[model samples]
Target: MGRPPGAGAEGTWESALAAHLAFRGAVLDVAGSTRRLSGELSRLGESHWGIAGKAAGLFVPHVEYGQSQLRWIDDELAAATRLAHAAAEVEDPDMQLALLRLAGPRLEAAMMGSMLLAVWFDFLNLTDATLSRHLYSVETLYVKMERWQKMLEPSMSALASLEPEQVESAAEDMPALVGHLTREFASLLDTIHKGAKVLETALVLKESMEALTMLSALRFSLPAMRPALPATLGVGLMVGPNGVMMGTRIVVSAEWVEMMRQLVRAGVLSLPAVSAAVRIQAGHVMMAQGHGDLPRGVRDALGDAPEVRAMRVTGKSGAGMAEPPRHHVMPNEFREWFEKRGFTGKMRIDWFCVTLQQPHHQAIHGGGNWKLGRKWRGEWNQMIMKALRDAEVGAGRMLTQNEILKIVAGYMKLYDIPMNFVRCRGK
Candidate 1:
């Protein structure tokens, strides 16, 4: 179809109202669905490994990557809502028309002028989606399929050694169950790929407000047209541009449920970094002793392993080099604030600390060369605090350690911090 007059110029009150509702609905839907999946993952991971344990730490991330994306969507929604309210409801249809005719141009201008395209761009979020996978890590199955298959090899071997009864106690068929999960992971990736096709198409349409122009045409034309005309084409074009949400939890969580159950049955129940290193050297015989915690010393030699989380360094080494300072990931100044909201005595402000590369640390705290007092809430901390506050309000409860870490991950990615620099939970 040919382009409409005033394309990208200004949407009608109808289109603006539709865009406001549709855009906000779509953003919340994607973010909300992602949040739901994050919990599903948290449950599966922490159920076996403890919330503060290694399963949660493998990614040091996971759903945490979405924290900022969720908050960013929210900020855009808030702005859109305020702008939409300018075209608020009234008792009379005639009065509503009069308001639109009089103020609609300015209101639409305000909405578009406010860089509302950012909301659409974020919705597309091709780059943001990739980070979600890497930090969010469900895509560990899909993207790191080879790595996952390799990791599962031990669990598979461990399961194979068991008697039929031992396997039956947890899994119906050992190899078959593992095969099912691998297939499901592939299927899940296929589903995402299908959704990506939709996203890619929308991204093309989004250039120069072409999608908005289509929405404007639909606002006037759809109701009067035949019912079977695919009315969803226009307004919905903008809603779920990324196609990354909805029922995703079902697939991702299902994969986790089976994988964890299989691992437990196989006696391959060691953590990825710490305990795995200790017990794997102790070998499979340690699995026979019971799944209780190992002694701290058998694990001490294991800390040097690369998967061991990076620690916050302090002061100087025996060599007298000035170590990069360890700073609290959640600023220490707000300890009381976080404590009140479940940062807790046990979760420990120290556990949340990161020792950034000195240059990055100095950059974060104002600058390396400039005379500096550092950014408010450490600058990074301020936005993180705001995002977490918004999350608590959205989630309707105090955030979990896992949840807080996810938010921090999201913000760190925003600052372009390297993933290796992220100081994980549980030291």
Candidate 2:
């Protein structure tokens, strides 16, 4: 593909530059919201007692995680801004291509980080809802018992922070994070249930109808919050509003894609190869989050058709079994296909194939099952994916599958298998 006319035109480049800035602003917005939510949680902890007190403790770690992630996003955005500015100033096509190469991944990372922050925001909202209901019940019943409603005022202030925007901001974060928060909050809900029951039982000691009535209302109100909790904490973030897409597929912005295409056309990037490398990285991200199948749009963008399956070779005993199989077997056709497509030593494929083989002769004879070996391979694959993404940007092109293998093998010595044992047999 050749560079289109006016690819370096000021208007064309400025529009692309503007998109990066817009993405940065979105990320900053999410970061600001996170900071506010965390502050509110800390204030709530200071004022509340009983169920709210317990919840405040559970929320502490999550808030810290959100803040840390926000800092990382800020760093990425700053780097992207600098690169885009440099790219915009350069007249030389090669220099511009080089700048775009550096900027593309950073922008993509910022967008992804923003989406993650959005998910965390959702979790904070769910926490807020539970706190709100508890505070409301306390305020209502305290007045009936002749205790001043002003005594419950601190909790009311905490509830005020659960604005619609703050709650709605969490709609786009990662499903894995949402799923994790859901489980954590579900556990917290169980604690709340038990605490409420214990409080109800103790109220019987007073033997006053007023005390019992307060207890009844408290019990009823707390459980009412339970139904709302699941929608917000459990299922809401998972399926989202549409209840269809399992994970957020926030595609790389088109401006970034166009920039990459210009770089490729200018001989700064290897066509098809860089695209394959990027799609592979994206696939790994999805798979790590437990979505093994790529969305159709993503597949189309990568020029990967539905019929091309990434081969998965499992041992007959178990996929991650302790013992190595008597013989390691791979489909001959799969091997040929991989070689033909120049995917021979791609880190992901390499790790999969290498780990599937029986352990090194020393390990096998030394009574070591390939269990730990397999685990090591999995960890190394993840590291390699990160390395590959870095290499793609740094080199201004995709690393060949063999090149990726060498890089990963240097870091982790897990690929030290003899060639004879790797058998490619026909079905």
Best by TM-score: 2
Residue 113 lDDT, candidate 1, scale 0-100: 17
Tens digit of lDDT per residue, candidate 1, span 108-223? 22222122122222222322333333322343433453443343343333323222122222222222223333344334334444444454443432331222222111121122
User: Tens digits of per-residue lDDT for model 2 on 224-328?
Assistant: 235322222111112222211221232244433444434333322223322332332232223224333445453343334332222111224366656353332
lDDT of 1 at 298: 32
Q: What is the C-alpha lDDT of each candidate?
A: 0.36, 0.37
lDDT of 2: 0.37
Compute each candidate's TM-score over C-alphas: 0.26, 0.35
Q: Give candidate 1 regions above 4 Å deviation.
A: 1-320, 367-378, 393-397, 416-427
Model 2 residue 114 distance off true place after TM-score fit, in angstroms: 4.0
